[model samples]
Target: MEVREIALGAGESYELRLTGRGARGYVWTWQVTGNADAVSVSEAAPPPAQTLPGAPLERAYVVRGRSPGGRARIRFAQIRPPYPQEAPYDEFVLEVEVTAATGGP
Candidate 1:
């Protein structure tokens, strides 16, 4: 899968273009979240460093689902990046760049 990191301020927008072949009718979304700190470490010590809440400070997005057994191509230009300053809303534009592919000789 391929992920892209984009930077934008509040009220700003970005255009995301996607074109690929796949079983039509696949659902995809552009999600946004704010995380003060990631609880990546499973274990916890006496002093369990800093912690943040589990609420998405601010979120906004739009998506277009794919159609199964068909091609998927679309252009999205209605996105306004959030500004979760308190939580450092560093957006992560993650998409299933490649779901499946047939072999060739």
Candidate 2:
């Protein structure tokens, strides 16, 4: 299963966990193209270790909502590396909606 959409508060952060096969040198790397002012993205740590070949690994994508009323779109690609012209093995997209933080009345 994969995440299609998500919601967050201003200044709040969310961790997106993505799973893929990593034993064969194919790694999932993310790129955030939209809503730069309202959000920030980073890779938290290395993916989990797999016990056997062709096993799946979980990668953490750390996304923080910087402001309200904007959307952050992230794309994850399974790259085999050393070949720029070749297409990725897999791709996934995650959309984030940043809402205003509620305050005391």
Candidate 3:
């Protein structure tokens, strides 16, 4: 597993890119831990064309800061479904800190 830290302002968001072997049934999944209310995560819309077999698949997840002055952790894993008991092939952890938005209109 890999860990990374990031900072975001309230209502601000960041994009995380993940690459996996989707062609082989491996998909990326995530969960929010700690201050879950402080952040929200969603997957971006897929591209128009279909992914080719045996090719790497790319996915983008948008992590938005929903509340200020809090921290959250997003855990990600790449695994094949129908084998929930099995271990993940890859994992990543994102530590996020949300702060008050800066500047004025």
Candidate 4:
């Protein structure tokens, strides 16, 4: 598993991209934990279709800061369905800290 830390202002957002073997039925799934209310996660547009077999696939997600003075953890796993008991081929985690947005003149 890999972990990353990030900081954002309230209402700010970032784009996350993950690669997987979609042609082989592998997909990336994600969940939010720890102060979940502090952030919002949503799937972005799908990647362009791949013509080659067993080609790598990319998926994008948008993570937005929703509340100030809050922290959230986002976990992503790449696995195939019907094998929930099996370990994921890859995993990634994100630790996010959100701060209040600064005022502008």
Please give the TM-score that candidate 1 achieves against the real structure. 0.28
Task: Assess candidate 4 and give its lDDT.
Answer: 0.90
Q: Report the lDDT tens digits of candidate 2 across residue range 1-105.
A: 255888889878888777766777777777776786778888888754546767778788888888799887888888888776778888888888999986758
Off by over 4 Å in 2: 1-3, 48-50
Residue 1, model 2, lDDT: 24
Any runs in candidate 4 off by more than 4 Å, and if so which?
Answer: none
Model 4 per-residue lDDT tens digits across residues 1-105: 889999989989989888888888888988999999999999898877655777788889899999999999999999999788889999999999999976779
Each prediction's number of clashing residue pairs: 9, 0, 0, 0
Candidate 3 residue spans exceeding 4 A from truth: none
Model 4 residue 88 CA deviation in Å? 0.7
Leading candidate by lDDT: 3
Candidate 3: 10-residue stretch with minimal lDDT: 45-54
Worst 10 residues of 2 by lDDT: 47-56
Q: Which residue pairs clash within candidate 1?
A: 23-68, 23-69, 24-67, 24-68, 24-69, 24-70, 25-66, 25-67, 25-68
Q: Which stretches of candidate 1 lie over 4 Å from their true place?
A: 20-23, 35-105
Candidate 3: lDDT over CA atoms? Answer: 0.91
Clashing pairs in 2: none
lDDT of 2 at 25: 79
